[model samples]
Structure formats: C-alpha cells, structure tokens
Target: RLLNADDPFRKAYPSESPYFTDMGMNTTIKQVEKVDDQTVRFHLNNIDAAFIQNLAMSFASIQSAEYAAQLLKEGKAGDINQK
Candidate 1:
C-alpha cells in the first residue's frame, strides 16, 4: 500500500521510519505500474536515495493484483497481509 495515499497503513508508520520523509511518505514516488507477473515499474518525481533504500524495507513487498482482486471479489480485501 506504499503508493496508496489514503491507506491507513500510512497513518501508522513507525516512529523511526528512516526512509520516510518529513511529509510522512516519499512523495518523490509519482506512480507504480505493474508491467507483468515478474516485473513492475516505478515512476519518480526525482532521484531520491532514500526511495531506493525504501525498497529493502520489509513493507515494500510487491502485492499481487490478481490476489487483491480475488479478495475484493470475496469481500475479504482486509485480509491482505493479515493471513
């Protein structure tokens, strides 16, 4: 949910989130595009070293759109990362 502006997870960011900016998120990220099952694309407003490092953070995992859609269809989207 890193690119989700209104995601509740953003409000619960850890106090010591080093890769985060004073704005609470790396606003430098302009967009994220899923190229395929094995590839993705990130659009950035500028080159920020911290953004690169943010990829290594535990929460930076790539989510499966197909799985997300399945959850939505099943009315259990909130189960993401919980199970």
Candidate 2:
C-alpha cells in the first residue's frame, strides 16, 4: 500500500494526505486547547508521534461522521490503492 511505499504521494503527504482532501476530505481543525500561542493539544484519533508530525505539516483531518459517510459513498472505505 502507499503508506508503506516511498512514492511521491508518500513524500508529498506522508502522514495525513492532501490527496484525500482533493477527494473531498475534511481538513478542519475545530478545537485546539491552547496551552500557549505556540502550544495546543489537538484532538485526533490514532494518537502517536506521527500524529503530531502530521499536525505540524497542516495535513491533519478531523473526519466527522459526514466525512465517513462520504467515503462510504465513494466505495473506497477499505481500498487503499498503492499503484
């Protein structure tokens, strides 16, 4: 899958993908509990170091139920094409 590859897509958007946005992904950051102007706790699924990295790159998505429904409508809920 593309996540395991060194493809341009991986390089361009390694963690949270912008390509998904083009496919109508929701990239909204609704709430950030700011510890300071430069520090905030972001609510995200799959919490990990890479999640922080993805947030720093401005590529994170707050996938609401609506987005999930859209993905299902696209018939690509489980298909991740690497080729």
Candidate 3:
C-alpha cells in the first residue's frame, strides 16, 4: 500500500528519489502481498543477488505514509531533504 502507486504517498513522491532508488519496485518487483498486519511479501520478477543487502541500507529507510501525505498536502513535499 505504501510503495505502490495506488496510494497517495507513492503518487506524491517520485518512484526514484535521490535518497533511495526503489530498485525492486522499479525493476524486479513483480507483485506485493500483505501477508498479515505485520508482514508484507514481495514477489520478484527475477533473482537479485544484492536485494537483501540493498534492503538493509540506510537509504532504504521507510517513511511514514501519513507524514508524506501531509507534506504533499501542505505543498512541502519537495522541501524534503533526500538524505
């Protein structure tokens, strides 16, 4: 819900941001599933050797969708520092 374009957060923010590139969402993510309230599953289009490592990077930080939506609502979305 957060990463997909169907949500307002993804729509407000660019798919590829300077802070982090959503490589899987851009290339390898064939599908996403909400397994439970605490879990989400990613179905990759192909094998990715660095996928786990990339996900562990600080650049891959997850931001609050509500905050992002608020930023966009206030027109302060672009004011966010990528890093």
Candidate 4:
C-alpha cells in the first residue's frame, strides 16, 4: 500500500537515507502480494541471491496492516516511515 505513486520505485542507499533505503527496498522490490494469512509473495526486480538474507536484516521487518491503517485514519501517516 505504501508503494503507490506517491512513493514510486526509485534507487536509494544507506548513505542517502538510512531510515528509508538502507535495505534497497525501492530498487529491489517490484511488487508485493499477500497470498494468505501466513504467506506473502514478493515480486522481485531480479534474481537476488541475498534476498532471504536481506529479509533477515532488521530493516526488512514487516509492519502490521491494521496499525498502518489506524495511523492513516488518525492523520499520522507520516509517522509510518520514521523507522
């Protein structure tokens, strides 16, 4: 939901902004699909060998949709990206 036109795909690096791009989300992820309650599918831009390893990193943590939606409703959407 966050990867819409307002935040479209673009290259970013840790040096540029650690809070936003240390894990290279902009260039690496092509799309995301929630297959089921326990599974999520990621459409990657390339065959990344370190994809799993990258996901193990702290920056790759997934946020809860409920909390995100709540924040959006409360007009605190900007806070969602403040990690």
Candidate 5:
C-alpha cells in the first residue's frame, strides 16, 4: 500500500495546504471484495466526501498502472502536483 504525508488528490480542489501534517495521519486501502473484473471494494480510514470526489476524478494522468509508475520513477509526476 502507498503511504504519504499528503493526499495527492487534494490538488484538484482549492486548498491552502497539501494535507494536515500536525500529527502523523494515515489512510489505508484493502481489497475487501471484488464485485467484478473492473470493480472492487476498498476499505479505507480517515477519508471523507471530498476524497471520494477526488477518487471519482481519477487523480493524475489517469493512465494505466505501468505508465503511472514510470512517470513516478522519472519524477515527472510532480508536473501534476498543484501545490
């Protein structure tokens, strides 16, 4: 699972800061069940309605996993960072 100090999706919305860093926080995701080949249930923590909206928007390039990984490896993902 990926863990980080900021919610990367926050860039899509207007915000003064990236995400709260006052104290360590986390959001966890687990594949609880698979509804179908294209769908799955995920368990999460510390998420909210805005986060859900961000998910629907498919944050970042919305490309396949492999391509996204390549962008991240090359440090080009920062180009999508709104902050």
Candidate 6:
C-alpha cells in the first residue's frame, strides 16, 4: 500500500516516496491491486519486456508496508535511508 499514491502516508510525504517518480516503479506500473494476503497484482501501462528484469534489481524490492507504518507512527518517516 505504501507504493500507492492514494495511500495516506505516501501522500503525506511526497518527496520521500520511492514510487510515483521516473526513477521508481511508476513508469512500469499503471496500477496496483491487492489480490489477497500473499498476492498483489501489477497492471502495466504497456508491454515492456524489460519490466521483470528491472524488478529483479536490488532497488526494485518492495519494502514492508507495515514497517513503513511503524516508521510513520514513530515519526521517523522522513529518514528514508535508515535501516
């Protein structure tokens, strides 16, 4: 959910978002949906052959939304580089 622009936390910190920018997954994904507890569906805007390959890169990993929530609750959302 953190990657979703409509999500509250993402909206609160626009500059800090790893999504919604050219350098991020925004260009590859047209939309996203939660399929279930263990599944998510990405709707692509176009057929890009390199999409999966790009996702395989280290920076493409999706961070835990719950962890992000924790950061927000603890007022640490601004520190994006913190592990």
- Candidate 4 Cα lDDT to native: 0.62
Candidate 6 clash pair list? none
lDDT of 1 by residue, 1-83 (tens): 65564664443443334544553356787887889878778898887766657677665665677887777688675665565
Worst 10 residues of 5 by lDDT: 16-25
Instruction: Give the Cα error of residue 72 in candidate 5, in Å.
Output: 2.2
Sort by TM-score, best first.
6, 4, 1, 3, 5, 2
lDDT of 4 by residue, 13-76 (tens): 1123353355666677898888999899999898878778877765566778887777667766
- As for TM-score, the candidate ahead, 4 or 6, is 6
lDDT of candidate model 6 versus the reference: 0.65
lDDT tens readout by residue for model 6, 2-57 = 45657555555546544335454676688778999888888988887877777776
The residue ranges of model 6 lying beyond 4 angstroms of the native Cα positions read 1-25
Residue-level lDDT tens digits of model 5 in 1-83 = 12332534343234433232222223433334668867766576655555444445423123455655665676665444332
Clashing pairs in 2: none
| lDDT digits (tens) for residues 1-83 of candidate 2 | 12334533344433555543453323333344769755557554333444444444433433345655664577554422221
Q: Model 4 clash pairs?
A: none
Query: Model 1 misses residue 57 by how many Å?
Result: 1.5
Candidate with top TM-score is 6
Model 5 segments more than 4 A misplaced: 1-3, 6-37, 44-63, 81-83
Q: How far in Å is the alpha carbon of 60 misplaced in model 4? A: 1.9
- Please report how far candidate 5 places residue 71 from its true position, in Å: 0.8
Candidate 4 regions exceeding 4 Å error are 1-25, 81-83
lDDT of each: 0.64, 0.43, 0.62, 0.62, 0.43, 0.65
Global fold similarity of model 4 (TM-score)? 0.61
Q: TM per model? A: 0.61, 0.26, 0.57, 0.61, 0.32, 0.64
Pick by lDDT: which candidate is best? 6
